[model samples]
Structure formats: C-alpha cells, structure tokens
Target: MTALAGLLVLVSLAALLWQRQHTLLTYFQQEEYDNTRFFTAWQNVRLFDLRATATIVVALVVIAAGAPFVGVKLALAAALAGIMLIERRYRFKKPLAMTERAKRLLYLSFALTLVLALLTVVHPLWAIVALQLAPVTLVLANMALKPLQTRVNEGYTDQAKAKLARLDPVRIGITGSFGKTTVKHMLAEILEASGSVFYSPGSINTVLGHTRHIRQRLQWSHKYFIAEMGAYGIGSIKRLCDFIHPTYGIVTAIGDAHTERFGSIEAIAQAKSELAEEACLAGGTVVVNIDVMQYEPFQRLKKIYDLRMITVGAEGSDVVVDAQETDGASWRISLHSKLGLIPDVTYDLPLLGAHNVTNSALAVTLSLVIDPEIADQIPYFTKTIAQVPHRLQVLDTPGSALILDDAYNSNEQGFMSAVASMDKLAKKRGGRRILVTPGIAELGLEHDRVHARLGEFCSDRCDTVYVINPSRIPSFAETIDADKVTVVEVPSFAAARAAIAKDLKQKDVVLYENDLPDLLEEKRLL
Candidate 1:
C-alpha cells in the first residue's frame, strides 16, 4: 500500500510539475529569457493571496491532524490533491511555445522535479517543497543552458553577418522608446516604391531574432533591410548596431516607455543614440523626429558626427508636417521639407491617430534620402501603405461596437493619442467612447504619476472606463470622476470583456489601449 501510494504521489506530482512548467516557460519566453526579470516575476507570485494562503494552511493542518488518524498514505494523498487544486487555479493568457530552447529547459525542469518528488516518497513532508520548485527548477535549467545558448546565438549571428556582407542590402535601423515598429512598416512600404524591401517582420528586433529571419527569409533581391531595434538597457541598441551595422538610422521619439528596464529616461535616450552613432560611423544619412532631437545624447551626436541629419515633426523640422485633417475614415496630411528631399504636398493617409502623421513623415523622409526619385511616388505609396495591425488599427464590425486596437506595445504618448482618437470617433459616430486598458507597464517610479494624468485625460474623453489589473494603477481610479465616467475595475481582460459584452451597444467605440503579457496580468505560485 505504501509503495503504491509513493508511486502515485511521484507520478501525480510529475504531471502537476509539467503543468506548472508551461506557466514558467511562457513568462520566461515573454521576458526574452532575461533571468533577472523571469526570477523577479517568479518571486512576485501572490503566494499569500487569500485563496492560496487558505489552501496551503488547510493542507498543512490536514496532514498534521489526519496523518495518524487516516494513515500516512491517505493523508499525503489528500494534501497532494489540495496542492494540485491550487496549481490548477493558475491559467495564463498565453500558452508556452515548445521551441527547441523551451524543450531543453522543460526537460531539465522535469528532471529536477523528479529528483524532488523521489524525496517526497521517503517522507511526504518533502512534497511541500517538491511542488513549489517549478520556478527554482526553471532558473537552474536556464543557468545550466546559458553556455549552450550563448554559443548557438553566436553561431546564428555570425551566419547572419556573413550573409549580409554577401547580399549587401541598404540596412536602415529604426530605434525608439515608441513608434519604431510603426515607422519600420511605413518605411518598408514606402521603400517598396523604390525596390524590393525586407523588414524585420513584426517586432522581431533582437539580434538572434533578426539573425534567424535574415538566415531563413532575407534574400539577394532585398534592396533594403529595415531593422526595428528595441532596447532594455544602455548597451542593448549598441550591441544590435554592432550586429547589423545599419547605414541609415531613425530615432522616432524618446519618452518614458521602458524607464523601469533602463532605470531612467536619460538612460533610454543614451541607448537609442547608439543607432545614430553607428549610422554616422558608417557615413549614412540619419533621419530623426524632432521629439528625439531634444535628448542631450542626440544633441551631442548631432554636434560631434558630421552626418546628414534630417529632422521630421509637426514644426521647425527639416521635413515639416504642415497639417493633418481627419477625412471620415482617412486622414489628409500635408508635409513639406526645407531639405528639398520632400516636395511640399498633401496626401491622403488611410491611417488613424495624429502621431501617425509624424510617423509617416519620418518614413517618407528616410525613404527620400535613399533615392530622391521616390518623392514623385510618395502620394501613390502613401495611399497603398496599410495600417500596422494593433497599432491604432480600426476593426471592421458592421453592426457591432467600433474597436480601435492600439494594444501591441503601449507608450504614454501613444496611449493619449489612442484615447483622443477614440473620443473623436465616438463624437463623429454619435456614440459613447469606451476605454478598456491594463494601463502601461515598466514605468516604475512614474507609474502613479503617469496613470493619474492618464486617468484625468480619460475621465474627460471616456464615457466609461474598464480598468484591467486595477491594483497596478490605483491612481487611475482615484483621479477618475465617478459621476461623469463609470469606472469598472476587473481583475483580468476576460472579466473586462465579459462586462463590456454585457453593456456593449451599437455605435459604441471601445479603445483597447495596451494588452500586457501573462507576467503583468497574472501572479500565481504555480
């Protein structure tokens, strides 16, 4: 009986551990295998949440009281069942992908779980520790695989470097705290008028991610390779610049987008300047938004580097956006440049948001730098340029409520713009403006201050606000006018969706501002 019970506990625990592994790996992948972030997220699990704390306490009491009365095997079985219930409560918004790297980590994690489970068989008390080892096991596996991961990454990077040398595509690196991805897509579309353009598809900005795409997809016919670079720290963009060696660089804007990761806004600006420094070194023309030119690092780079600097923005820029007028579903934008690269012209942009006018100007400016002849084709190319999905994308639902999805990667300016867009659409459509968001992430010390401002802005524009993960942004609710706007706090997106679905009416405009990953959305021990 004891032997059978021990085997059952080990087998059942193995299954439970496997389930927990997926949650860990999903976050690990989302964090881009950053061990510090992964472990920090792990440590933040709400282990003492009412339900979890109660489950643990009951299991402990059941084991102590019922061990001698019900016999050790049955008591242990009951405790295991209780722990399994708690594990099952955890459900992630996104599932883990079983990639080659994930599989290696999964294997090592399972092996660690087995070793701990075997000890539980000797004394069931070990089960307590065994079941909670998922995060630790994942950390150990990642630490063990670091050397192999580094070597593999280096191999792919080298191959990509060699391939780029052979093909020699006009490399253009775009980096910003925000708007980089949008600009990459816009530039790729505009450059298509010139020749074949191959961009890092859909935020694949990392060195390895770029290397993988370059190895498999980037070819000889690609006239331009647009790399959208992202940075978590000061040297991150510099390392990517060393990898791609872009001839052209665009700093779209600098803001408090990832101040948590970079430590400060100054650090972020310094990191984004790496692309400009590298582009200047390569003797390539650099296009910068006037917003980014305010940064001291960019000012220093402009003074030191003798590279062509093309500035684009609303005003006082080389490429100046003269005006942006909403024309029903599309926007009519007028852009003129003092640099003479862009001819003064007004073109219809089939995109939403006021910031997109600046984004389009940035792309158009960079596109003209490569080939002056492409200017005549801008009006036609701008018409064909499709809106980047999930970045102020308007969803088509004939009879349903209108949804503006600016949910890809959220920044403060983008969020404000999205809200303003939603309000305008609601007024135009004669409907109530609804805002559903989890708020922005990685703001760190600025979290409350930013959210208060956002809440104040939203209170005026939004008729009703659905705040997902309300605890993360308490100031959002505090600032909101309860009488003017209905503030509904929901624990998860699903809950918010349920509430919205119940109250949704035709002509209502709902703006899904920022969809955070599973890490920010849910915190659980399992």
Candidate 2:
C-alpha cells in the first residue's frame, strides 16, 4: 500500500507539474503572469497532494512492515479520490481553453494509480504498510526538489507576451507610476457598466502572473479588454503592452513609485510612456494625461504617431472634470459635457486626501473617451469606490486612539499626503498627532534624504514619534531636534506594536506609515 501511495504521488506530481516544462515556462514569462495566483491556488491543492500520496505510501510501507489489509484498501481508495478532487480544483482555477494540459496530465496520473489499486486488491495488509511508507518518503522527495520549481519559473520572460499582443484583436494598454490600479478599476467599472470587460484584478503585473491570467481566466466574451500595466524595471511595461496590444490607452501620472528599481524618474517615465507608444503602433488611441507633469515634459510623444492621440487633463481635453475643494472635507465633482454639467453637484466625500480626488478625476477623464455614458457614471464610481485597503484606513481603537493604518507601502508623495491629512484631522479632532513609521524605502540613496524630509515633516505634525527602523533614525535626527521628536526605536513590527500598544490614549491619532518588504539586503531583524 505504501508503494502504491508513493507511485500515486509520483503520477500526480508528473501530471500536475513535471514533463510540462514548456507550458510552465511559456506562461511564466508572459507580461500578466496570473500564475502567481495559480501558484497560490496550487499550494491550497497541495494539501490533497500530500494526504492522498502520503496515505497510500504509508499504507504500502506499513504493509511491507506487515499492517492490516482492511486499513490499506480504504486508504488506497481514499487517495485515488483525493487525486481526482485536486485536479477538479485546478479546473476551477483555470479556464476551459487553457486547462487542457492539466486535464490530460490528471487523466494519465489517474491511469497510473490503477497499478496501486491492483496491488491493494492482491494483499490488503501489505498494501496498508506500503501506502504509509510511500507518503513519508515522497513528502521528503518533493521538499528536496522544490528548488527546481524556482529555476523553472526564472526561465520565463516577457517577450512572449509581446508576441501575443501582435495577434491581440483589440488591446487597451494602461501604465503609470501611481494610479494604474485606480484607472484599471475605473476603466473596468465603466466598460462593465455596458459591455463585456476583461481586466485582471489588482496588481498582477509579473510575467508568469499576467500570462496565466490571460490564458487561464480571460473569457471569450471580452470585447474591450483593459489591462493595467505596472513596472519596477525598464522593459516590464513595454513587454506587457506587447501582450495586451491595447487599442486604447492611458497614463495617469509618473512619480517616484519604483524609481529605486529603475534608478531614476526619467527611466521610470520612459517605462510608463511605453504603453502609449505600443498603443500607437497597434493603431490604437493613446489617452495622454496632459496634467501629469513628468509625461508632458518628455515632449517627443506629443509629435509622434499618425492618429493615436487623446488628450486628458488641464488643457484641450474633450472630457474634463472641474474640481473645487471646500475646506478639506469634500470636493465638488462636475464634468464638462456638450449637454452641460454631469452630476454638477458637490458631495461630501469621507476620503483622506487630494490624491483620492485626483485618482477619481483621472478615471473620469479616461473613461469618457471610449465610454461616454460610464464617463458620466464616474461621479457614481467616485462615490462608491471603496478607499483602497490599508491606505489611510482610519480606525478607532478601544482607548479611542484614532489608528490610521496607512501601512500600505508608501512613497514620498503618499507619506507627505498622509502627514498633511493627519495634520488636518489633528486640527479637526483637537488632538496631537502621534506617528509610528518605519520611514520610506526603495528610493535607493534617496532613502536617507527622504527619511530626513519625512522627519522634518513629522516634527511639525507629530507630538511623538515611534520609529521602527533605527538605522535610518540618525538621518531623521539630523532633520529635527531630538528633544522635540520623542523617537522610540523598536527592532521589529512586533516590538514596535508592543511598545506603541501601551501609548494609545483617547483622542490620540497614530499613523502607521511605510511598511518595508522583509527581503531588504541591509535588513534589521528585531
């Protein structure tokens, strides 16, 4: 039985992962790699991979060591069912068109399992021992071979996605530093308001993640597919546009989002503008944000292309939004239409800062071109658009501390905006602002300078500062006097949480700013 279990495990592994290096690598290198999500889904299915395989292996091994017949047979049948069920899970994750390979593999693995079934039929007691040992041994083998998965993944590139975009019927590429997600969500919402829309959810911008998403889940009903292209590298956005082949496009704004990865803002801008260029070559309309400072300054894009031009923001834009802010509480949302004001009324919004308003405005501008009705519907999306999770999400703690969980990985603009918001709120709530931040990262050498500025900015807003990463604290200390800034340095989030956990009082506002990734080379572990 243990031997049978081991064999079943091997068959399942082969069926699911092995002998299909081509398919895996091809999907891995695509621009919109949705395989990361698939990988996550696969991890969920791996439970069965272990249970079925291990149970049969243990049964066989135990039988080899001499176990009961009844136990081994039951385990063998259960293992078989587990294998089938896990494959079913894969089908659920992937679309019918792309799941052919997985389906075929599953069939082959199930056929191999028949050998174990025959073995169990011969001698049940021996089968049980065989199954037991099979699971234990195979589990160790899978663990040992895990590194091969990483190597398999690394071989995938973004070039293939570009190849597909050349064949894409209609591609609408979108890229920017800050508001790609907002524009993606807005475009999806507007398009979905009328016709079938195919857009990836959230920020699945890697090669493997996007390709699998495009291949596995992209529905046939998709007429106008909106893709939000994001980047941390030079050619990432261009590669994605090559895959998407968007006929219509938008670039919201370029800022210091991933300048650390690309080295400079200009490099970042060029990467972002690649979307417009790709759309132009595809004979698609490129919606240029005239309001975005960086893209406008680049200059050359304003001259190139025959007909790929749609101006948005500030100047000669057909669809325009006029915003008038009133005392930091709400902004009047009005759209310029030939028929006149579309929802030309000011409504109170509970959002934190001007960035949210700008994001909504960009949505309105971009949505108007391809989708006019939903362009008018932007005000509604604005009202309904949930504040992005963990970005300025203010909560009331038990002690009534106004806990502002702005822990979503922040940039200079975001951090500054958060500080400004807290300052406004501080004035409104009549309480001193307390900030617990680890400061900004991924700015390369600008880390120290950004930290210094943040420290200076915080000195004006925060009554107390709970610093998380102490190595950057000296840069901050240089910006502000130590006496004015009460800096409590904790080595870890856990420790910071522990120390600051006791500092909350009624009406004390705390901002948790800038959570860093765990993989920093000069990492400080508390």
Q: Per model, how many backbone clashes are there?
A: 0, 53
N/CA/C clash count, model 1: 0
Best prediction by lDDT: 1
Model 2 C-alpha lDDT per residue in residues 1-526, reported as the tens digit of each score: 6566555544543343222222322222221234343343234323223444455567667778877755655555555555545544431112233343334433343333334444644654433333333323223333444466456544433443543454343456777776666567756765665577776776665556667666655655666667777786778877776555677788877767666678988888888777777777777667665655345433566567633565545544533556676666456656554433232323334567666565665555555555556644455656655566667776765758687778774677778888878777777778777777777655765767777887888788777777775665568756755667677777656667788768666776778876653322123110
Show the lowest summed lDDT stretch of 10 residues, model 2: 517-526
- Name the candidate that leads on TM-score: 1
TM-score of 1: 0.94
For model 2 the local lDDT of residue 505 reads: 66
lDDT of all predictions: 0.82, 0.58
Alpha-carbon RMSD, candidate 1: 2.4
